[model samples]
Target: MELGYSDSVRENVEILDVVSASEEVGILDDVINQGESEVVHLKVGMKFDTVDEIYELYRKYAQQKGFPIKKRSSKKDNGVLRYICFACCREGKHKTDSETPLQPEPTSKFGCKAKLSARLDLDEKWRISVLVLDHNHETSPSKSRFWRCNKKISNHVKKKLLLNDKAGIRMHKHYYTLVVEAGGYENVTFEEKDCRNLVEKERHLKLGEGDAMAIQSYFSKMQKHNTGFFFNIDLDKEGRLKNIFWADGRCREAYKEFGEVITFDTTYLTNKYDMPFAPFVGVNHHGQSTLFGC
Candidate 1:
């Protein structure tokens, strides 16, 4: 069956015009309408006027129950949505990193069976058809901050961070101001490191083309000289260099022998660019400090 939006949905959106701008980024902390009558209690026969309404109801329910939700699947008929499914984030298994056996496996998925399915009815309303609420793992609302779905950096906040950076305000101070204005760290959706990353990105963009190109050329030369040389460069949204890391043939060989315990330190700054200097260090057989990579 095909679906259509009801006029009441548009009217409801107009009535909710007073929502905070931060909500435009993603799902915010307070998602449900506060009215006691608006509480979401999913059932097989529950219906919604719009697909967004159904998703909002399910998201609010998942947040309150201390779990994350994601759109599992959807079906469309004649370019119109006919069926949709929402399920716990930990509903499937993740692929293993067989190439890197030492790397730890992800613990997010547990074959969770909790899900809700809805179908468009002849009357155009979405009615729930399947509801499996049992979870294979425990849930806690207190840990909602860690949910990727709940963590968002709104555009308003991004602009504020950028302005503060240009004004020479330290990132920690500005981050603290945001936390205080929001009432506490718990109230803030993002962490201080997130703001630091933004500032670092801006600094990276300020790097001159000569410096970035020179660094790339050096890496290319080294890779050509030694086949075991490996490197990775991170770029910003605008395709500018954000960061880079490299390891020579010797460093990779040292890692194969002393990779069990390695240390990464970034306490120093480069003399020319003033960028943070990090080095990977390992202990040798003679108890000497050996360079792994940087």
Candidate 2:
């Protein structure tokens, strides 16, 4: 059978909207609404979601158990593909970097290592399977935020960064605002350089290298359909589009009548590609604003 969307899981999106070929395993007489109600198959602690969600659940469980927890280890660097396993634990003292040659001896550390591991099962919607939930230390209330996960960035801060990114805010400005919103730069898990890289990467990803065949494909479709459309494009020496003008048959006819005394406005909204957007306007016989070109 022919496949659907190329990628399996969605990015910065909901998996509920993504329907795969596997979802339509059997063709029936009547179509079923996939979003009506999902088949929630699970045991007591088992759940269906991403590994990050599982980690959050684990963290919440540890917190409810009156113990501060930290991620012991993870199987992968990114995504819940194939297989991913992570261990959450009741943390103790910080360890010294004894592997370094310049480090001193007798590392000052604590004595708590209660841990639990959650593994992703590939067969069942990447459901989290609790591998182990063991604790050797006595359970107690959290008094301080010292031995917590230092690398854990809060979801609120992440959402703020993503929202600002969508709002077209630059990185340095965003970093300043984010630091203040996060209480201080020291409170944030990642560095300023990380935010900068993320913003730069987002810029590249959002406005990727323009599709090379887009213009050609458009022109091909226009020629194939034999539409009476006029178009002009001026490119710089580097094959970059500097100026483009297009007018459909109807627009051209309107321009032919209200052609004289056309006022061109070069001032308008700004674009990232540094291309000028000028609109040609004119007043018709009825004294109403009429468009000539752009």
Candidate 3:
């Protein structure tokens, strides 16, 4: 039977020297890379909340270092990982923009050879007990923001961003504020372009295609929901809504009395769909300008 590693080989792999837990993971990663060895036994004294914390930290660290990570849980419910491993990078497209899976999910595939096992010590703290981290292939470094999935913006953040966008804050400014609120750039896994894309996506979802059919649907719903509504849609020779006059009962009654001498203005406020929103105004007996029709 082929043993995992000889005692002599184990002697050279005592490479867990770092200040913080994240840094320890980083140091172990560097040792694994430099020594071309994945069989380091780390005796860490760090305290973590849960086994998942250790796994996520290590996984994030590995991905940041341009190494593909894989993990597996012992079971569901108590479903934190029994072990985590770094997979061999397949010689294919590594671009994050490309259409492919970036991080390796939990699997029993043979491609991932580097392994790590964690257990709770007597002090009620998690420790890396067994680590077999020797990779069979060479790897390259990658920017952490490009591939990290953990640092996604939550729905709460997105809502706040949308509000800021509507309030006239610049797109780049909102992104910068979000990064600052996140504590720093390291905490934000996604890039600035991704942030801008989210805003664009929200706008697209709100406005749809902005086509003629969409406009008609909106007006149809509005007409059905109102009882005092009066609207005249004038279609051109091409069967399009060329001109529209719409008003409620109150406005139509006011127009009957004041529509004789009206001032038309189409140069004021514009709509998002590039539709002209002009209004007619007339002077009432109170010597105040009153709206006649729109």
Candidate 4:
């Protein structure tokens, strides 16, 4: 069943078809001729004057299996008539000089084009190798959005912020003491009693009273000028303002009136210990103030 070039042959010749009686005799003759100088090798093997007798013996063996004998001219040496039998069940003429060698058709699978080759002589194994080539098919577009605000803010905050997820905006409760120097707020200091009262109420609801007061004061000041407020919320984290019913209702009204609002909703808090605080501030028509509440 094994097929390959004989070790005695110098050239890299591959035997493609099934081994026939004539082929075996031709191979044996080549082996003996190459090793004729060695006496020990010649003594162990029988010498054949003609390949015909060897082919006849092979014919008898093949006849038992109902195989037909064939005649072919040797490509190796011109004018050398060689007797062969088609042992392979499949029907195909032998490849000629003008015909290309048998090779697998190119195919695209497993992310690349693969080439296949069969070697009956070399262990009778099918070898497959991949080659990277440009494909004509179009590639799929990326799923991520180009102007992803959440991704930008998430990178700025060093945290993951998924869109449409419930989130809150508030002052830094634990680091409220640091806001005195942050300079973002208008008034930094309040009475000790006022701070204590606000803290008590905020602690009862687990929210920041100072932040709520800042928002309420801002909106009340804007209301003096009869302005509308429009804003957005980070719906990723749980926050007091995010859950506030009145502030959300007012924002919806403002959106309807102004057609659009310039609101920058971000969660990067000035105080590291505090949650993100999104403050919405904009100017509306008629020189009125548009504000975000809570």
Candidate 5:
């Protein structure tokens, strides 16, 4: 057998020495020493044909067990030897392929059959409380329908009622006031004063109908104080209003101060030609006439 620098070669050499050598006869030791030298010679004497014969024998042994050794191209360092596992047939790195079948799941040691269950509950006590409050308010005679209570007063009373009888404090006070004042009638009638005062205290203030009418009358008085003339007139050559019933009264007054009068025909042919109609008036200064038409 040819020997190379491998752990198997070393093991074989040690085994040979142990088998041949003995304490009584040194002849076996001599034989072992010669055998080691012969092993080196055997390595140098190995031919390509011998290697091929040994490989074929190894291949036959491997085939019986299903392992197949494949040889790759030789490199400067070492020849590549691909070893496939006999049972798995996976090659390289001694690992199973990623496509390998999965193992089965394990069964439970103990079996139970109770289904899970759950439910939710909501508090509905507020509905009853609201009904009780409505009934109490409707039955109470002392509750005023005309007068609205203030929030500050009601809140204070509610707290007192809660302290005295907590069950009765469930209903909130629901009424408020809206106050209206008269402009020139700040002193209300005795019968309406309490309602008006309660209204003024609780809600937005507003002007009453009487107050609005008074305001309008006051503005009218102010306008009259600044008024200079009440009517307006415009005259052309005729003694009639120029454009309409209302005209420039200032121009008429100026003409009146100069004692100037105007006259002209107040009639014209209508579209029907049978009716006498006039749509405008004119003015005459001395003997000259100027007409203003509608």
Candidate 6:
């Protein structure tokens, strides 16, 4: 047992060594070389070992051409993968709604027709079938990193971010340290926001049990008794509860009678989490202040 365990540990160390060496060598050299026409050219009938290899080559081409590519589609036959397609990140038309939202979101889609299609051959190798290099809009290599497809937080960066977070390092300082270590912002594949998001995700995952679950349970119980009770819980990107609002049937009935003048106050400091306790209040027919919602 000891011998097997030692062998496994040695194998793991060897794998780590290889990974470290690869990271030290870096992919920027290849991406930089892609600036040359001969290096970045993607011709139909190009063969690759795997789908990722096809993506890697196309991605280098996109880096040179200053466009982002996304995995658009894939096909499988009898549980065997066969065909795949990669398209410009901004290939589709943005659907507009009749009623505009209060905070309208930005969109990248513009019906750009740039794409690359590849198919699997009998030799078990993937071959490019179609290639469309024409793009409808301007492309900027300098701004390519801002695109979702181009930005990636590698495992090494994640480890560093986790370590810095555990040491109580401020986000800005840690990000700056990473930028310095990477040589410049250009060499860093991801931005500060991406690091912050990863840190938040890790922190949330570490919090095995949160107050949000208990609050949700209480809300569920309340809902069972009062079907008319309406409740809403807003969660952040990491699934952490940000805000919660609930109103019972009685509150709704009271609101119908005395909601002519409703007051919403959040001045109360009533929780250990330092979150504000907001409540909707109104005056009843008997001139008594009644609770409407919270």
Using TM-score, give the best candidate's number: 6
Q: Write the per-residue lDDT of candidate 5 for residues 114-162, one digit (tens) a residue.
A: 1111111132111111000011111221221111210112333223323
Candidate 4: minimum summed lDDT over ten consecutive residues — where? 156-165
What tens digits encode model 4's per-residue C-alpha lDDT throughout 1-294?
866656633221211111221232332222111221222211112233344543343333323323323332222225533222222111233333544447644332222221111111233222212111222233221211111110111121111111101133122321232122223222222222333444344434334536656656666665566554433322224445543322445665665677366665666654523454555655667767775443
Can you tell me which runs of candidate 4 are displaced by over 4 Å? 1-250, 265-273, 292-294
lDDT of each: 0.76, 0.52, 0.55, 0.33, 0.29, 0.77
TM-score of 4: 0.17
Span of 10 residues, lowest total lDDT, candidate 3: 15-24
Tell me how candidate 4 scores on lDDT: 0.33
lDDT of 2 by residue, 106-174 (tens): 632345544545555545455554455555556653421233532343444455556666656555665
Which candidate model has the greater lDDT, 1 or 2? 1
Q: Pairing residues by index, what is the TM-score of model 3? A: 0.38
Q: What is the lDDT of residue 176 in candidate 6?
A: 63
Candidate 2 stretches greater than 4 Å from native:
1-208, 219-226
* TM-scores of the candidates in the order shown: 0.53, 0.29, 0.38, 0.17, 0.13, 0.58
What is the model-wide C-alpha lDDT for candidate 3? 0.55
Model 3 misplaced regions, further than 4 Å: 1-48, 70-74, 77-110, 119-129, 140-142, 154-160, 169-188, 200-294
**Which sequence of candidate numbers ranks them by TM-score, best first?**
6, 1, 3, 2, 4, 5
Task: Compose the digit string of candidate 3's lDDT tens values, residues 1-294.
Answer: 976877745432321111122222232222122221243223344446687777666655555445655454342335643333333333223333444467545432345456556666556676666555555555444443455443356555566556666766666665654454456665565667776878876654133334556656766777788766667777555454467787776677788887779888777644443456788888888888888768
Q: What global local distance difference test value does model 6 have?
A: 0.77
Reference-based lDDT, residue 67, model 2: 58
